[model samples]
Target: MSTVNILHMKQGDGEMSYAKNSTIQMRWMNMALPIVKNTIKEMLTIHLTSFEKLESFKIVDIGCGSGPNTLLFMSEIIDTFYNLSNQNNHQSPEISIVLNDLYKNDFNNIFNALPLFYEQLKEKYGHEFSQRCFISVVASSFYERLLPSKSLHFVHSSSSLHWLSQVPENLDNKGHIYMAKDCLPIVFDAYKNQFNKDFYSFLNKRSQEIFPKGKMILTLLGRSIPEPSSNDGCCLWELLAQSLLDMVSQGLVKKEDVDSFNLPFYTPYCDEVKEIVMKENSFDLDKIEVYMCNWDPNDDEDDDNNIFDKKKSGENIVKRIRVVSESMLVTHFGELPLDTVFKIFAERVANHLEMEKTKYTNLTICLKKK
Candidate 1:
């Protein structure tokens, strides 16, 4: 089976859909707003100032996943461009959008959302918005070259690049699905090598596609420290492993199945990202920052470690996880154990949170083509 077949988020806009559970993803995108706003202004001043408004300006969203936020984010970005252009007394330029992702991504959901999305843009910017905006899709992988040479301006992505092209070879990550405390040296080495290789190739490809001054803002699930096994980085999987082990004890899941599975996901440290960018040498690292959010996207735990209503928080976190992971998990563990494993996972998460607070850490990386 294809990788896309195995890795898509839950489809539809139902309660359990990525559309419903993407508050965390939206928050990550919104956190990049200050940088995004600055980028648009710079693009307007530097590039659009010399061009005819009738000419098309292209932007690409690499790994633009499904959810209501898919078009919502793109529309807001266009609005930013036009609004900033208006401020500078420039005519509106045709905005061409290229939405690229794996084959099985829920492009249908994104397509269904378009009428309303266009209406919202009309509501805000009127009929002119319709003429100035163009949207297209390339059903392919970012790990391969997806666009023409120097064909892109102001590229963007979020919660994407951390996914390796494939799972690492020869994982002996028995009993754990990801990097964790006490994970063997070989396991760590496999993950590190895979990420390094995939990421360098990704940069080399993207470097060719973006214009000389084109910028990319990539936000990913990542860590504040260099260690992949750190609490904020790998604790989520460790907890998931504990839940799977509990299931094994109950005979609800096979011990061997639990032992052999490992996620194709990695959350890199800021320094790790810096080294890769430096090694690639195709882009200048403008800014890279680490930010933390509560594991429960909706958690208002405030400045303290207080997690009131632990059970509710646990459900929230697990539901968020389920939307992203359910398909691959069901394929590996079968549909029957789905609810049971997740229920156990939620309980484990609540208990773990009760002991101490752990926030999800992420990296927002900004780059300029060199």
Candidate 2:
């Protein structure tokens, strides 16, 4: 299925909405903020030390999912400039922040919150300063160019790029929604090839939109090793697959339905990312770092590695996955079996965690246009 049409986060701001279930993405956003702040400081010192020539500092947050985080980054950027100007006595430049996401994403929530957010900004930096900040939301696919040439200053994205434009054409990945330990080599190759193609297009298009020397910081699901079926890569999916198979045994779902499903996602190795940037030749790979997030987002105590409550941990993990994947699953599996399937999935996740703890590795890559 095409992600452009069929894929989206569960919409609205209710308990089950993506809005309420995005703590993991928010965590990554916080982790990447220091990098963003330092880059903004560097840009001020060199490129836009003075806004005499450049009137506005323009930024686009590609795949900026709707939620509390929608405006959090933008607010931080404004504060960065506000603080710098106060400390250095530099003139504050007008700022523009664009939020880009798939058309199916729920944008109304963002629209509703803008007025109050703007009001709060007015209190922080005064009315005139707030007036200089512009906010726009665009519904479009990032695989294609969604901005004018040489118009952007910086780009930021988190928890977005791992989704391919679509499921690879003619994939025969049966009995699994994603690459698993027993997945065939042919299936793995198809996924890798699709990621290469999609990422190349992404870079080529960004090269057209961003000004020379502009930078982008992207955070997405990734793997530490080259193997696609490794623990950090596919263990979560394998557990979910086990849940589906259990339902198959109960006749709750068709075996054929389970067999035909495959996700439009891929987590690449650091080497794979390096190779792609070199091949594209449009961006300089500045740095790549990996951070391990537990399958349970709430599990953050470094000294505590034990799962005291396996059932709660499993439920927490499934909530995160469900907010993001529910749309696609409903499109493919119908609504009747979703609750039951996910209940079983949570149980399987709990059982799996009892034996071993696994994490999702996120790769944060920094790139600058060459």
Candidate 3:
């Protein structure tokens, strides 16, 4: 499937909406905040001497998703610039923030929340500071150019970029939605090749848009191991495939349906990401750090309990997965078996978690445009 058509957060604020079930994503955002702050600080320092003469400072959040994280990031950037302006005894530059996502993204949700965002900004940094910042939404895929040449100062993305533009052509991974433990070597090569191509295009476009010495911070699902088939990266999809296969046995879904379905997703190792960045020759890789996050970071209390609560943990994990993937799944498989599939998926994930706590290795990389 083309990602532009299917890859969007669940729209609206319903129970199943991405807005409601995005705690894990929120955590990933929080984890990336330190890198964001440091980059902003460095940029300020590098350009401090010319602060008085500067006109506007442009920052973009690619794949900004819905309201919560986007608003939080905008607020942080505002705060950073506001403080710098005060310290230097110069007026803050007119700030332009562009939120970029696929055309299907619910940009209405973002525009609707602007009144409150402005109100909070005014409360925090006076009405004048709020007036200095301008926000706009750009609906387009990041694989291509979205901004003017050398027009951006800073770029940020979190929990995005793992999605390919589309499923690989002529995929033959039968009965699996993603790379499985039993997948042939060709299946792995197809996924890796697609990622390389998409990522190269992404870097190439961003290279033109970002100014010299501009900074970009990206956080995405990745693996610590060099192998592409690591469980930490592929387990969720494997479990989903199991759930669908279970339905097939009961005649709820066709075998061919399961065989043809493929997820346009890939998680790379930290080294793989660095290698591509170097090969692209557009950005200097400053740092790439991998953090292992629990499947349920909020389940701290359950960690100490003698008996693990599989049902509760399973439900939590399933909700996270469903919020992101449900739209694509329903689009392809129909909505008749959606609930049942997730129910079975929850059980499988819970059982696995009970035996051994699995963690997602998230990669945070900082780059500077040359």
Candidate 4:
């Protein structure tokens, strides 16, 4: 699909809510931010920063949800320079940053929170802090609108690339007879297409904008082993679909619609990503490593855990199977009267465990410009 068509398709999903008072989303963000921040920091230390002496730096956090990652890096750069000079009683280096996301992002909350974050830093570091640094919010898609390419020193994004403009065209679930077998391929093609279109544009654009030797550190959902049939091994998403199926049985919607209802998300395999990047010829594969990130806990520990353990082993199996379903449920059904829907979904998951088992693993990619 064309980028314009994809943007329009995303519009139909409704606006991405940016309300600060949002509670459930806040809970989810609270769980996600720290993990993402630490990972970015770790990647920077291991892959991006090679020399100690520094000069002016420009950094960007794409899909910078809420700005914690952006703030973390900025603080780290300043601190690194300060510590290096601390023993010598010298000056700190200067840095400028830009945070970008879709124009529809909740800039109100970001603007409100930024001044405070800015003040805290300025107070400790003195007036020079404000002079050398800048933080501005840019509104654009990662596949498009990032300012002056070769201008950035470091670019990072986490957990955001998997969403494409819309479901793949061939898989459109407007109606189908053999959805069970056809569903996986349709979903895969839609994701593959989105990556091809968006990332291709992303590479071509970045090639022109990024300066020689610049780097992009991207962490997103990817297939662990390139299973043409598996959906990033996300059994939860499948179960969530089953829940949609249940909803249909209860007269909520049509079965034909269910078959055509492809997920609006896609996770790329490591090799697929490498192919796109290598094909560009402007980015040399500095270091590409794919490791498994396990987000599931095996313990029966909290209120959420209680739900997982209370079921019979048979029921437990379904809950286990729906791990992907649970994630999908949380992704979309999180805010909806979760109280009862969660219970029904959990029960269905437990009952279905007899048929399948599921697990999820993420892929991380690190690259540099040619």
Candidate 5:
């Protein structure tokens, strides 16, 4: 029998183009993704510490955006061996890691960045570093990608799975009601439908490909409190979208186009995730927790503003947020003139968020293969 549990996975559709240019935005993610990676890594460490049976393992990183988290794991593995060597005078256990994500991701960027990470390792541990490291990047989707059965030991992804290739065809974002009550169900349903279809397929495929004792650690944007009617308490995605709409009135974009643009996709609460993962009955629940991400220190807890003022002092914060947010938007809205559109979008989001308090609520899960 297979045991399965869902904590939280998808938060919103992923935007791809964000990290391509701005080092500042990329740096911000460096802080965010690592925190997420460390949290999951601690979970994995705790689980591994109790396992009496140990062997060389293969690590698979899904949706390895920029490969930061993948490298982080590698760093952890190296630390594990180094600590062991210091204690018992033994070499680290041999491990191989593979990085996988959509073909469009900045693999070259990752490759270019590798020298720096490798240098850090070599500087710390000398020649022993290169001999133990095996890293490869695979460009493909989680469902259709090919891998040998029972070949992987650990699988991981962060902030990447929520994006569906496209928004559901039936979604209508321009409805008259703008309150949380009116907006909640439509988006949630779209997200739930997409995840059930794709994520189910992903799990079934993995069930065939991974060994019985392997494990997966996944962290995604989530809602700590269920939003049956509105998007409050959800991740910061909707706030980003509202920022984009602010550009329309400023001659940067058209209102009709903004209305037509729905967030790419996301999934529902933990139970919904469990329904999909449990299909093959091959996974065991280990840990599931929800935490918040991305915060504005100046926000007021009880105010709402519809228009973002791009001209405000410190509004430059949009540039940092824009790295990922605009990247995804440009990928989808490329036809629109970027300079004009982004100017309006930034100004609007700044103004709109001037009075609202928000945080990123995320779901983190760790599962052991049965």
Candidate 6:
């Protein structure tokens, strides 16, 4: 199945939901706040001066999964506008916010939270500000067009663009779901080619929807190292692959099943992202920065001695991995193995972290529609 059909964050606010297990993403969002704030400030300064001529200011959060983070973004945008409006004594333009994610995302959760979201916004920014904001959801992949021509002024996505529209075709890495240190060269080529195609398509489509000079901010998994299979870049998937191989050894899962399964994901290097953006020729790259984040950002509970708590750290990482990947794994491996597989996967991650702290490089980019 295509990722568009199957890939979605775990739904709802329950223990296993993406909403519950998204602290890492929350941290990423927080990291991007300065860029978001500055970008909004600049956009508003330039675009809102002619507020009388505009119908509404449209901002979109691409791949906006359910819950607090999505609503948090809405609040941030409104608050930014509120502050700017106050400074200029300008009436805030009618605001239109669209949240975009895969077709399978739990938009109902977002919609259901609207009452509380608006209530909080009203309390924070007053009824006039809240009343001016309108919210909508679009269930679609960002690789494809999600809006009309020249409709959006700002687009923001965090920790989402790493997902390709589908797994690379004809992958033959054998037992690996992602690039590995010793994978055949063809495997690397296939993955890189897929990302180039998907990313170009994403840029091409977005170019049609955003007005000239509109801003797009994207924060996604990436690599600082040049090697595609570097441990820092692919260690999470490597450990997950090892866990699956362990199951294969126990006769719990078929070897062929593991061999055939590949994640519809890729983490590009900073230069790779720049290359594609330049090649696409649709958006001007404004800024790109890479940052490293721990596999478990909430691992501060360690003792003064700094002994590694394998189980605690493993559980934290496990919750995050499970929330983002359970749907894909369950689809490929059946629901029976979900608990067992991740249990093994978590233990393997713990062992790896015990040996050396594993970090993921995140790439944040600012783009302007050309």
- At residue 215, candidate 5 shows an lDDT of 66
Q: For candidate 4, which ten residues in a row score worst on lDDT? A: 1-10
- What's the residue-level lDDT of 294 in candidate 4? 24
lDDT string, candidate 2, 248-282, tens digits: 89988888988888888899999999999999999
Q: Residues 126-237, candidate 1, lDDT per residue (tens digit)?
A: 7975767777777777777777777666666677767777779888888899988888989888998998998898789888877776777878888877777888888988
Residue range 1-370, candidate 3, lDDT tens digits: 0000001111121112222345877788778887777777776677333666667776666666665867776687678778888999998888777776666667788889989998998898898988987887766677777777876666776776677778888999998899877899999999999989988887898889777777678778898788877889898889999999999999999899889899888899888888899999999999987888878766764466645578888888898888888887777877547889999999999999888888889888888888
lDDT of 6 at 365: 86
- Give candidate 2's TM-score: 0.92
Give the TM-score ranking, best first.
Answer: 2, 3, 1, 6, 5, 4
Cα RMSD, each candidate: 5.8, 5.6, 5.6, 8.0, 6.4, 5.7
User: By TM-score, how accurate is candidate 3?
Assistant: 0.91
Tell me the tens digit of each residue's lDDT in model 6 across 1-370. Answer: 0000101121121112222346887788788888888877766557433433444666666667766777776677678778877887877777777776666667898889999888998898898888988887766666767677776666776776677778888888897889999899999999999989988887888788777777788888898788999887788998898899998999888999889988877899989989999999989999997888878887653447555687888888987888777877777777447788889988998888889887878888889888
Which candidate, 1 or 6, would have the higher lDDT against the true structure? Answer: 6
Per-candidate total of colliding backbone pairs: 0, 0, 0, 13, 14, 0
Lowest lDDT block of 10, candidate 3: 1-10
Least lDDT summed over 10 consecutive residues: which range in candidate 1?
Answer: 1-10
TM-score of 4: 0.70
Instruction: Give candidate 2 regions above 4 Å deviation.
Output: 1-21, 47-53, 303-307
| Global fold similarity of model 6 (TM-score) | 0.90
Q: For model 3, how many clashes?
A: 0
lDDT of 5 at 32: 43
Q: Which tens-of-lDDT digit does each residue in 1-370 have in candidate 4? A: 0000001001111124122212322233344434434543443346444323345555555555553444554565555445554644644445555666666665576677778777877787777655666676666666664566346544554555555544556665433221233454765565577767766776777667665655565555566766644634445455556666666677755676556555555667778888988787788765555544322334233456354443354344444434323433445433444334445666665555444434345554556667
Q: Local error of candidate 1 at 351, Å? A: 0.9
- Quantify all predictions' global Cα lDDT against the true fold: 0.74, 0.76, 0.76, 0.51, 0.54, 0.75
